[model samples]
Target: MAGIEFEIMEHIGKISEGKSGWKKELNLVSWNGNDPKFDIRDWSPDYTKMGKGLTLSAEDLKSLKNVLNEMDI
Candidate 1:
């Protein structure tokens, strides 16, 4: 299945700033040389109920913005 890809730097930044509760929401799929990938479906509370996952929460977006603002990103 085609999946969304995210940069590791961005991911770590989000984790550090609590922008995404990803650690609690999704599982990390790592590779040796290839870029890591994540299945958005895995993060959803109702994966079977819906065809796709929910968007990031407003609080999460705000937190992400705060993190990005604080850092050079």
Candidate 2:
């Protein structure tokens, strides 16, 4: 059997931090050696673990940007 593979290509920024020091971050990640994508998730302090996350492609990111731009927040 083979194990899943992933690489954190870049550390973008931290969105928030939890009490235990885990951080919710946005990063560029490549899974299974595929192209990198925008990823948002919670990561352990040492980055040895991660929580569920959303991965977005360039087109998806563009759409998200558009929607966010139109938001009042």
Candidate 3:
């Protein structure tokens, strides 16, 4: 299976109740070192239908770290 990694850029807001709120905008990036072929603008993940928030498996997180380490970027 092809490995995938996700990165999130969030804009956080501070609430009057002394709580922090974040809106996560995600980017699914690949380490292939080439331009992405698909359109990211059309990409969407319906967390409500999936019954979960954004998350990754342990193995996937490890792989992503490895890729980043190897690239040293």
Most accurate candidate by TM-score: 2
Which lDDT tens digits does candidate 2 get at residues 1-73?
1386789999999999999999999999998999999999999999888888999998998999899999998
Q: Residues 20-45, candidate 1: write the lDDT tens digits.
A: 33223332334343544442322323
* Clash totals for all candidate models: 0, 0, 0
Q: lDDT of each prediction vs. the true structure?
A: 0.37, 0.92, 0.34
The weakest ten consecutive residues by lDDT in model 2 span 1-10
TM-score of 1: 0.25
* Candidate 3: segments with Cα more than 4 A from true spot: 1-53
Better of 2 and 3 by TM-score: 2
Q: All candidates' TM-scores?
A: 0.25, 0.90, 0.28
lDDT (Cα, 0-100) at 42 in candidate 2: 96
Error of 3 at 73 (Å): 2.1
